[model samples]
Target: MPVIKLTSNTTLHYQEMNRGAAETIVLIHGMMSNLSVFYFNIAPMLAQRYHVVLYDLKGHGLSSKCTWGYHLQGMAADLIQLLDALHLRQVHVAGYSYGALIALQTAVSYPERIQQLVAIEAPDPFEQQTLARIDAYSKSALLEQIAAAGKAQGKPMSKRQLERNYNLYHFLLKQTTLQQDMLAEKDFMQQPGIDRLLHNTLLLYGTDSPCASTGKQLLRKIPNAQLAWLAGDHHIPVQQPFQVGSSINSFLQPRENRIHHFQPSATSIGVETPGWNLAM
Candidate 1:
């Protein structure tokens, strides 16, 4: 229920844990999802080592709804506004899916305000499937897609969950500019300067995710990045929260030479160098 009024005249709901830490990590959720994605599992884990911040993005979760500013630039700007309002000059940040794109954009736009970077299951915006989904977005289509995905995993969603999801999906798809903003960002990954992100970066992707190729692309783009694969596909966080949370904790561990390796064969690129550590 805690919220902050952003400079944009919107109120963003956020939660903070492990106050008074020397450093902070901001968690951003993907399109249509909210801070709860991390509140239960990931935030608590990171709070053990660093102050953690999780907030609902504009028009999602408990955040005040808006019809504008869905582009990556606007999204990154919202993040900066949140940071400034909280008086945080810099933070470590992690985001999933489209949220990851916003994190990458933030790093590119506000390098001094960032420390380490973590990207989980960030899809390449240019993927045809990604565009198709945006162009074909509909509440019913989303329900069907979610149902199909749920069925594939042999887990049927309850009626209450479906209703909740539908309300959010309907607003984002049929009632806002989000889809257009998303389609406009199809070339985001191809933009210059993204290849030059200087933060010690962690790229976490699902071993079986179609977006693994994008993770590989990011690994190649960021000079000081390491890639680790988790067990699930796009839903890695929900499917393997403990593994995901622990991996993030180990990466953010302050002590030098402290590293943890994921299950064998799940990692693609991991190396140790002077003054930096890699999550294997």
Candidate 2:
């Protein structure tokens, strides 16, 4: 596994593909999920046309665990630091579920550092159901949920995988501030500047997903955002990876072509590299 140590002294696990492609696209997975969400199917499709980057968030996957910094702002800051470490000035960003919220926060805070944005199945932070679920999370509940998810997908959970997942859950729930940090941002979408976001954005939601309403809310807020409905629910990325990948690829292709034909203008967002510092 590849690791990059952030300025905060935390190390993150990441993977890259098609490094020499015309443009770079960064993929962020949702809460309790890792970059593996993209690594298998989506990244490969995008890599055919763009440089694709994927990383595990702090305390998730192979990344170093910490007790704080699970909030959106902090998560976005971590991403910025990672970009700085990788020498990438600006790149397209795509995120799912909680990761989508982080992507929105990043665009709002550092509009210049993002070329375009894709938000998939991002629930509204203010939703009561979202808060209630976090409040109810527990080690036993997590294991059962994972097992049920596996059964639904026709992949029965193995003892080894279950044990590994249990360990991860125990550490994150008992040792870290993830739940509290997430709860603190319950009103994030209603905050100032969210509705004013100006990036060319794509909002993807599953037709049957409860989060579809949130996608609609975002479409009304973001100036240039377009919403598209997929076939499944919150797990659309896993259930329909090829379709998701193709949609994003088509949405991003025109911009990538334009970059090759013209030099970025002085007015371009993030054209002037800005110094970044740890948000802690």
Candidate 3:
């Protein structure tokens, strides 16, 4: 329920934990979802050793709603501004789904302000199936999707939860420019700087996820990156939160210790964090 107004006058609701820790991490939830995705399991586990901030993206969850600024460029800027307003210098960032793309964009645009990157199930926007859900938005479909997502997490959506989620969905699909802006991100993965990003990065994807291909693409695109497959599909994080949280924790450990844990696949090459300093 915590809220912050960025310099742009856009307000965002966020959750924070372990504020007194030495290091800070920000978790961003994907489209149509809020901070609660990480709030339940991921944030708590990461907070034991690091300060954690999980915030709903603009136009989602209790955040300010705007018809514009749904593009990655704007979303990334909003994230940086959120950090600035919170007085956080540089911090680790982890995002899921579309949120993952925003994290990459932020790191690409403001490399000096990022300590590490964690991208979970970041799909290629160019994929037709990726945007089909957006283009084919329907109120009933949204409700079914939310209900299924909740069911995947081992709890069916209650009537109130279903109504609340549907309202957010209707607003985003009907009142906001989310789909159009997302469509504009088709070239995101091919950006010239991708192959050049040297941050210590971790890529998590469901083994069976169609997005695994995009993860491989990122593994090849990012210099110091590695991909780890969990046993699930695109809903992997919610399907397997403990595994996801454990992987993130192990990856954030010291480089030497972390390196051995990530056994590489043939396509997942050159995984090392030589460009980042551990002292941070």
In order of appearance, the predictions have TM-scores of 0.85, 0.84, 0.85
Model 2 root-mean-square deviation:
9.1
What lDDT tens digits, residue by residue, belong to model 2 across residues 141-207?
Answer: 4555567778799666677877887787778777888878877888898987788888888887777
Scored by lDDT, model 1 comes in at 0.80
* Candidates sorted by TM-score, best first: 3, 1, 2
What lDDT tens digits, residue by residue, belong to model 3 across residues 136-227?
Answer: 42333455567787778966657896688778877887788888888898889989877888898999888677687889889878988877
**Any runs in candidate 3 off by more than 4 Å, and if so which?**
133-158, 256-280
**Candidate 1: residue 249 Cα off by (Å):** 1.3
Reference-based lDDT, residue 105, model 2: 95
Best by TM-score: 3
Q: Better model by TM-score, 1 or 3?
A: 3
TM-score for candidate 2, please give it. 0.84
lDDT of each: 0.80, 0.80, 0.80
| Per-residue lDDT value at 225 in model 1 | 78
Each model's number of backbone clashes?
Answer: 0, 1, 0
